[model samples]
Target: MANSAPASVWRNPIHFLAFGLGSGAVPKAPGTFGTLAAVPFFLLLQNLSDVQYAIMLVVTSLVGIYLCGKTSKDLGVHDHSGIVWDEFVGYWITMWMAPAGWFYIVLGFVLFRLFDILKPWPISWIDKNVHGGFGIMLDDILAGLMSFVVLQALVRFVF
Candidate 1:
């Protein structure tokens, strides 16, 4: 079963981050809301060069492993519903090198959320087989990559 938001999410800095800065604390569809919260951060990152953006992705992803694992362990839950850092990172990944416009942003959002929610093929496999914080983040990472491909393609051809 899915785990609910814990008090530690507000009290502990790590939990606060893992929960996507409290965006995950929402009672329903926290991942969606958490991804919504990520939009502003993505806007901030849009100005970065590709290399710098890649570095930021790496840093955030690495930190997410620790934040998610520690928070899940503390809460005694595996991939708690409120842990939405993965969603934030995933959304960011989807928007990598995307065109600067509301259309691209919204498209990236939809694509990322679709892949994340659907969890096709390897994503579903990894989600089932992996464990701990890395596991929690891996599935979303794949989803982001998949969405990135689609979004980039749209930029190249459709848009």
Candidate 2:
């Protein structure tokens, strides 16, 4: 079940970001909403050069650790379902070096969501055992990377 959004999500700036600019507050499928919210930002980032995009991925992922951790701490929750800055970073990772088109964007979204939701192998293991903000971010990071590999392959071979 989805954890309800804390009141601070609106009042606190950090919490607001952790909650994916309020996208995570939805009653159902907050993660999906959060990922969806990331699409626009991804579109904007597409303008950047590959190196710039990679830098953004690293910076956002690093900031997400603190944002998610601090918000979770403030709310006394461990990786609250409402905290979704990680989703933004994860989606960004999945789109790295992707072709410039809506088709690839949609495909990256689907692939990233699949890897994130399925939690295969080590991702599941890490999600189970890890704790705190880094733990929360790590699993999605893996999901994005796994998605990245597959998306790249599809671009290379099939699409």
Each prediction's TM-score against the native? Answer: 0.98, 0.97
- Global lDDT of model 1: 0.94
Question: What is the C-alpha lDDT profile of model 2 across 23-90, one tens digit per residue?
Answer: 99987888899999999999999989999999999999999999999998988888889888988899
- Name the top TM-score candidate: 1
Query: What is the overall TM-score of model 2 with all chains considered together?
Result: 0.97
lDDT of each: 0.94, 0.93
Question: After best superposition, candidate 2 residue 130: deviation in angstroms?
Answer: 1.2
The candidate that achieves the highest lDDT relative to the unseen native structure: 1
List clashing residue pairs in candidate 2: none
State the lDDT of candidate 1 residue by residue for 46-100, as single tens digits. Answer: 9999999999999999999999999989988899999999999999999999989
Q: How many angstroms is residue 122 displaced in model 2 relative to the true structure, after the best TM-score fit?
A: 0.8
